[model samples]
Target: MNLLQKPILFPLNEKVRLIQYITGENSMLEHIELSIYDIEPGGKVSYHEENFESCVVVLSGKVTVDVLNGKIYSQLGTRTSVFDKVPTHSVYIGKNRFYTITAETKTRILIAASKTDQSLPDNLIKPEDVLIESRGSYHNKRYVQTILSDQDTISDKLLVVEVYTEGGNFSSYPPHKHDQNLLPKESILEETYYHEINPTQGFVFQRVYSDNRLLDQTMSCSNQDVVLVPKGYHPVGVPDGYTSYYLNIMAGPIKVWRFHDDPEHEWIKDRL
Candidate 1:
């Protein structure tokens, strides 16, 4: 199966351009749903999910979100690009709630959802609320921002994060897999990577492989492209002279994230 999904041009319409990547039938993912929205100024998109807890992440530009016709968050984002290295604004709406996003400017956003039985309060995660960290060392260096995690009680089966990698560097390195359900050793989780290149013309390579070689694929991903990791050790590498940014949405039977590195490559961590 081709894991890389390229963007398709949508018909010109007055409403926002919505690309549904993982809406049940179109994707191999069973526990996750992802969509991206491109909205012109004054355009709006409304949605209500009956069984999934959803998160709205403002990728760029500005917007206002209204939840359940009562609570409204105004002017939530201001980044010129996802590469701004600044934290983004995100909203979490629990199951069976209605929400509308109206674009105050030309905007792009991502929605990630997963099944949940819990109904929690809505939360507007401000830029300051996101935890940013510099991970790895030397060539493996990358920036990470946690948007939603198991630590946050708002969502039951969703985890979201944004990562930035410099040219000639690697992210999700040393090859790790979380396809097993072992508690402290590993947990089963399917992931989707929404990639954006700095120059918009550059590309990156991501490799997905398993230990027994049952699944192995290397995908060349461009801007606005998405790569799915159903079950494998997935890692990304950026070419020289271009930067890489990707928004990752993960979900599984269990909410916690535990990964085990490939045994052969596990020695690299000891040297680091």
Candidate 2:
């Protein structure tokens, strides 16, 4: 099957959307899952872990997360929006856990999950702890914030991060792929990009392809759209006047991020 077919993008609607839930059950993916929640003020949702570990990222607005029936509770501060250029907040809950989320205001949240057997305690990731770094150079430069990855916290099979590509800039550049488990070189991983374009009507372009060219696709993505990378060299570009924010969720046999740049475009690194 074509790898591009793995990516399922959904336009935002009045109800919550489960891109992963709709695509995962029938796709080749076995590790990662994702869902989006659009809640109004005073709205609440309850959850009980069912053999998977999950990380809830508040894309916008304030929220109170109650875990273990309130045994561990926290009221997370708010971000005006993902495009606000500020660090966001998140909470990670382990397998078989129970939790509830109540919104203090209109909000949007992304919940990414991966099956695991490890029993780790639930924890909150504060804005102060989010590591923000600038990568690439010139038009390729973009900001990356590590949310739940190996560098931030240990996880059994989940890696979460967010990236901001300035208008007209590029991200996940130099065209890289992590579809082969060649340790010390590249590790196989399945990834998903949940995008939110600033201005709501703006859009971005993402290309996913394989070395042999057997699977290739260039997608025009807009707000709340999702793109999945089962295996390929994926890169994204934002148009002028439209900043792009994408929450990346990934999983694989290994917990580390090891990728190989497309040799044809590796030369671009010298110019950066």
Candidate 3:
């Protein structure tokens, strides 16, 4: 129900923690953003989005979706994911109200006064299309996966990876960016860094711009923090003894895994 503007911080607690919508409207990617809902034991949110596609993942407790597939309410399993670009489905939490993330996949265009067509858009994914990767990508390479994302395999592919590192830095030593267009097999993808440093933890500075003299500026990011990267070259720096993680959501017009690092930091590539 809300779009993230500035990074909102959430403290770690013994009980369940809930961080609602990351953004309101424009804050979402392609009108899609992550929603974290906290539900109490036996709590439930009625399913019924006139025009919204929801995908649910259980980070903690188990949840069952008394879903309405065609006619009857088909009960889904724990950690059940649904690309509900079809109809409005309600959510009912189990023992403890669990958190649910909802992203809009169905394309709904406006026409007249609040009234528009309800036909399923081309991007509207089927229930089966919500593919979940149990075992993530890149186990080593000094990387860790937090969130399980269903990588979009459409024409233009943007890979979203929630990565964490132990005393290890990501995108370290090298600053990179791709600001061009190429064949589907070799295209350029923009990079953005929204940092989240643990509390009682040190700070991390991110430098972004078009190389040197490209309007250089650094921002101090911490827990529940964020930084936007539309274009230009950028890199992240995490001091020692601190752990960190980030949600890198991507989308392009092609289905290829290609990237280009900044000229200065490209040297570290050979070591990897």
Cα lDDT, all candidates? 0.89, 0.81, 0.39
List model 2 lDDT by residue over 1-272, tens digit each: 54333334353444333343423686667788787777677777677868888888898887888887435545675687887878888888888888888788777777888888788778788898788899999889899988877554556888999999989898999999999889888998899888888788998999999999988899888787778898999999999998899989998887878999999999999999
TM-score of each: 0.97, 0.91, 0.54
Pick the TM-score winner: 1
| lDDT per residue as tens, model 1, 1-272 | 77888887473477578664566678788888998988888998888999999999999989999998558999989597898889989999888998999989999989999988888788889999898899888778899999997787768898999999999999999889899999988999999999999899999999999998989999999999999999999999999999999999999998989999989888878866
What TM-score does prediction 2 earn? 0.91
Rank list by TM-score: 1, 2, 3
Ten-residue stretch with the least lDDT total in model 3: 106-115
Residue pairs clashing, model 1: none
lDDT tens per residue, model 3, 1-272: 12113433342233323443432254423322344444444444333434333334332233344334322223322222211112222222211122322222211110000111222211222234433333212312335332213243221233444444434464433565554575542454433343445533556666666655555666665655555554555566666777655545433333244456676756665655
